[model samples]
Target: MLQYLTVPVTAFAQNCSIVWCDQTMDAAIIDPGGDLDRLLVEVKRLHLNLQAIWLTHAHIDHAGGTAELAERLQLPIIGPHPGDQFWIDGLAQQSQMFGFPHADPFTPTRWLQDGDSVQIGQSTLAVRHCPGHTPGHVVFHSAEAQRAFVGDVLFAGGIGRTDFPQGNHQQLLDSIKERLWPMGDATVFIPGHGPESTFGHERRFNPYVGTP
Candidate 1:
C-alpha cells in the first residue's frame, strides 16, 4: 500500500509530504521546505528507508531545504520542471527576502517534465508540468493512491497567485481545468499551503476556476 503524511514547514507553512511504500518501507520526502528537525523525527519514527528528495517547484517555501537535506542524507533530488531553474538559482535571495533561514541553491538530479514518472520504492508517481504558480511548477500524482501534491497551484477554494514575474492567470486556470480536473473528482490533493481538498469540491466551489 502507498501512504503519505503531510508536514507543514517554514514560517510560510508549506506542506511537505513524506510518501512511502508500506510494503517496502521505502520513502521519499516531497518538498522539504523547512523544519528539518521535525521531518527527520518523522522519518526515524516511521522507520522509513529514506530515498530521494522530490520537489514541486523552486520557490523558497517549497524548496528551501532541498540542498541541505539531500547532502546530509547523500540522497538525490528530483523535480520541479526544468523551467524553474531561475527560481532554484535565487534560493538564497528568496530566503533572505522572506526572512527565512538561509537557503542554498543546488541542481536537481533530474528535472521533471510533463508525462514523466518517478518512483518511491515500488510506488510510482506520474508527473505533470503544471506551470503557473511558477514557470516550472509540477504536480505529482500517485495513481494507486488517488492523491496529488500540488505546490501552490490550486488551493481549497482558490488558485495560485499570478502576480509573480513568470506567472500567468490563464495558464494557471488552464492547467487546473484541463490537466488537473481530468484526474477525476475523487482525486485528493495536498497543496503547498492550506487544507487539502478533492477535485470535485474545488471544481464546484472554487471561484477562480470552478465550473459554474
Candidate 2:
C-alpha cells in the first residue's frame, strides 16, 4: 500500500507531499518548499527512511528548503528535467528578490525525464513534462493510484501564471491540452496549492480548460 502526507510550507504555501511504500517504509519527499524542521518531524513520526527528494520545478516556493533538508537527511535531490536548471541555480537570487531568506542552490543528483519512472517503495510515478509554469515543470502520476501531483501547472479553478522567468504561455497551454487532458476525467488532481480536485471536475468547470 502507499501512504501520502501533505505538508503546506513556505510563504507560497506549496504542498509538500511525503509519499512512501507502506511495507518497506521507503519514502520520497516531493517539493519540500520550506519548514525543513516540520518535514523532518513528520519523517520521524512516520518512521520513514528517506530515499530521494524530487522537485517538480526549481521555484523558490517549491525547492527553497531542498538544500537544507537534503543536507540533513543525507539524501540526493533528483530533478526530472534540466530546463529548470537556471531557476535552480538562481534560487538564492529569487529568494532575495522576494524578500525571503536566500536559499542555496542545490545540485540535483539525478535528472528526471518525460516518460521516466521514479520508484517510491513498491510503486512508480510516471513523469509528464508539463512546462509553462516553469520550463521544466512536471506532474507525477501513479496509474495504479489514479492520482497526480501537478506542481503549479494547473489548479482547481485556474492555471499557473506565465509571467515568471522562462514561462511560455503558449507552451503551457499546449502542455495542458496534450499532456494532462488525456489523463482521463477520473484522475485525481493534487495541485501545488489549494484543495484537491478530480480531472473530471476541472474539465467541466475550470476556466482555463474553457467551458467543456
Candidate 3:
C-alpha cells in the first residue's frame, strides 16, 4: 500500500506530503514548503528513503524548503519549468517581501514538464501543467490512487488568487475548467492549502466552479 502524510510546514503553513510505498520503503515528498525539522522527523519515523521532491509551483510557500530538504537528504528536486521564471528566480525576494521568514534558492535537480511521469515507490504521477497561480504551477495525478495534488490552483470552496506577479486569473480559470474539471467527479482533490475535496464536490458546491 502507498501511505500518505501531510506535514504543514513553514510560516505559510503549506502542506507537505510524505508519500511512500510500504513494501519498498521508497518515498517521494510533495511540496516540502517549509519547516525542515518536521519533514525530517516524519521521514525518520517512517524509515523512508527520500528519493525525490516534487513541487506544485514556484511560489515561496510551495518550494521554499526544497533546497534544504534536498541537501540534507541528498535527494533530487524535480518540478516543471515554471511559466513564471521570475517567481522561480525571485523566491528569496518574495519571502522577504511577504515577511515569510527567509529561504535560500537552489537550482532544481530536474525540470518538470507537461505529461512527465515520475516514479515514486510503486506509483507513477502524471504531471499536468495547471498554471495561473504561478507560471509553472502543476497538479500531480496518481491514477491508481485516484488523487491529485493541485497546488494553489483550485481550493476547496474557492480558487487561488492571481494577484501576485505573473499570476493570471483568466489563465487559472481556464486551467481549472480545462484540466481539473476533466478529472471526473470521483477524483480526490488535494489543494495546497485548506481541507481536501473531491472533484465532484468542487464541481457541485465550489463557488468558483459553480453549478453546471
- Highest lDDT: give the candidate number: 1
Instruction: Provide the RMSD of all predictions against the true structure, rounded to 1 decimal.
Output: 0.7, 1.1, 1.4
Badly placed stretches (over 4 Å) of model 3 are none
Superior by TM-score: candidate 1 or candidate 2: 1
TM-score leader: 1
Cα displacement (angstroms), candidate 3, residue 75, comes to 1.2
Q: What is the C-alpha lDDT of each candidate?
A: 0.93, 0.87, 0.82
**TM-score of each model, paired residue for residue:** 0.98, 0.96, 0.94
lDDT of 1 by residue, 1-212 (tens): 67999999998889999999999999999999989989999999999999999999999989999999998999999998998999999999999999999999998999999999999888999999998889899999987899999989999999889898799888999999888998999999999899999999999999988785
Ranking by TM-score: 1, 2, 3
Model 3, position 187, has a per-residue lDDT of 91
Give the residue spans of candidate 1 off by over 4 A. none
Residues 76-134 of candidate 3: C-alpha lDDT, one tens digit per residue:
98885657556667878978887776777777888878888788878777888988878
Clashes of each: 0, 2, 6
Between prediction 1 and prediction 2, the one with superior lDDT is: 1
Work out how many backbone clashes candidate 2 has: 2
- For model 2, name the residue pairs that clash: 79-112, 80-112
Instruction: State candidate 3's TM-score.
Output: 0.94
